[model samples]
Target: DAAYLQQQLQITLEEETGIQSTQGEFKFMVAADAYEETERVKVNYTSEDTLQQASTSGTQSDNAPVYDSDGSTKVV
Candidate 1:
């Protein structure tokens, strides 16, 4: 569950900030719920300015997918 949460958090952070962060140490604090039983997943990300610059000027455009279709998107 930690791994899945980490991946989801990474994707969400990247989409929001355009920065990717490696998973650092994680700490979990659990408290008993009175009504329901569920734990919230919270994510924190930190990236250096160099990483931001690299991501901005990196191969993002080159990594875009191109499709050859007649005004329609069809997957075969």
Candidate 2:
């Protein structure tokens, strides 16, 4: 359930680069899209990085943007 919740958390592009979502779901097309349109702005890490959640007690979590060799985001 944590993973699912985390994924929901990552659904933030709607607030960042696109229009607000309806229950976390958004429209990803105009005449047809927007990621490339917005230059792929840095949003929250994807649910794949949920393990990097904020500190639970006193330890901090390391959450840095991960990029593939091609310089594209690996998790975002």
Candidate 3:
């Protein structure tokens, strides 16, 4: 999936470079060597289950929980 996304980005950048050249601008060229690519992995976690359970009543901090689209919370 990353390879596919990179290919699409390359194509879009190439088109931008061509358009810029036609406009008498040379700043839109893309340099792959100037970029660093890293692979990102998805992580599953729950803050309400992991942190709230560990906090005692009246001792909780002011930090609020962040929720995902599925309604699961994850502490920031």
Candidate 4:
């Protein structure tokens, strides 16, 4: 039942992170001797890095701007 519980926890995680249930990838496993009422679970989430990288790349693209011959500045 630990594996099942882990899966349930993963679902709950998607709600908390706002990553969308289908957008992120997850791997969960019970990190205990067995499936017990007081057992602990281990989860490996692999999306935060991707999200961070995307945001970093997006910021770099913001530097692009239109140039004017009159030396005027404008953001578009």
Candidate 5:
């Protein structure tokens, strides 16, 4: 659905009032590029499942996690 939504938003709507005529006169939608720039969510997960568990003991000097500039993480 992300690809479909992205495709639909790419079409210029400045002269396409007919597309939204039945909706409402005052309705507005944010531009596609604006949506791409905004943050959606940041969740810190916690669980007992093997693949899903997070470190409950938290950060320690020798075993601290390293976060990269590109948003990846790794155990040090």
Candidate 6:
């Protein structure tokens, strides 16, 4: 459960970082207790500048199969 929670947090972090350039560093602090109805995870993020430049580009590429006339497949 911890691993899955961490993965979700990482995904959230990446998304947040992508949208806003000011979000520099992120720190996750998880509590040890669990709840019956809903579980709350605390997240803390810090940045030196209120408005910073983008740390990385926002381009994504995937390797999908492409079909040719001869039924051959190529990755693109």
Judged by TM-score relative to the true structure, which candidate is superior, 4 or 5?
A: 4
In model 6, what is the error at residue 69, expressed in angstroms?
93
Candidate 2 deviant stretches above 4 angstroms: 20-76
Compared with the true structure, the alpha-carbon lDDT of candidate 6 equals 0.51
- Candidate 6 Cα outliers beyond 4 Å, as residue runs: 22-76
| After superposition, candidate 4 runs with Cα above 4 Å error | 1-45, 69-73
Worst 10 residues of 4 by lDDT: 37-46
Question: Could you tell which candidate, 2 or 3, scores higher by lDDT?
Answer: 3
Stretches of candidate 1 above 4 Å error? Answer: 19-76
* Backbone clashes counted, model 4: 0
TM-score to native of every candidate shown: 0.23, 0.19, 0.31, 0.31, 0.20, 0.27
- Alpha-carbon lDDT of model 5: 0.52
TM match of model 5 to true structure = 0.20
> Compared with the true structure, what per-residue lDDT tens digits does model 1 show for residues 1-76?
9999999999898776643222221112223342124322211123455677688767675566566666664443
Tens digits of per-residue lDDT, candidate 6, 5-42, equal: 99999999998878665433221112223331133322
For model 5, residues 1-76, the per-residue Cα lDDT tens digits are 9988777776556336656763454343445445544533212222234333334344345477689998799756
Q: How accurate locally, in lDDT, is each candidate?
A: 0.53, 0.53, 0.62, 0.64, 0.52, 0.51
For 1-76, candidate 4 gives per-residue lDDT tens digits of: 9999999999888777775533443222332335542433322123666778888999888877766888777797
Q: What is the C-alpha RMSD of each candidate to the true structure, in Å?
A: 27.5, 28.5, 21.7, 20.8, 20.9, 27.3
lDDT by residue (tens digit), candidate 2, 1-76: 9999887777865465445454235443551256654543433444425545544422432356678999897654
Model 1 clashing residue pairs (backbone): none
How far is 65's C-alpha from truth in model 2 (Å)? 83
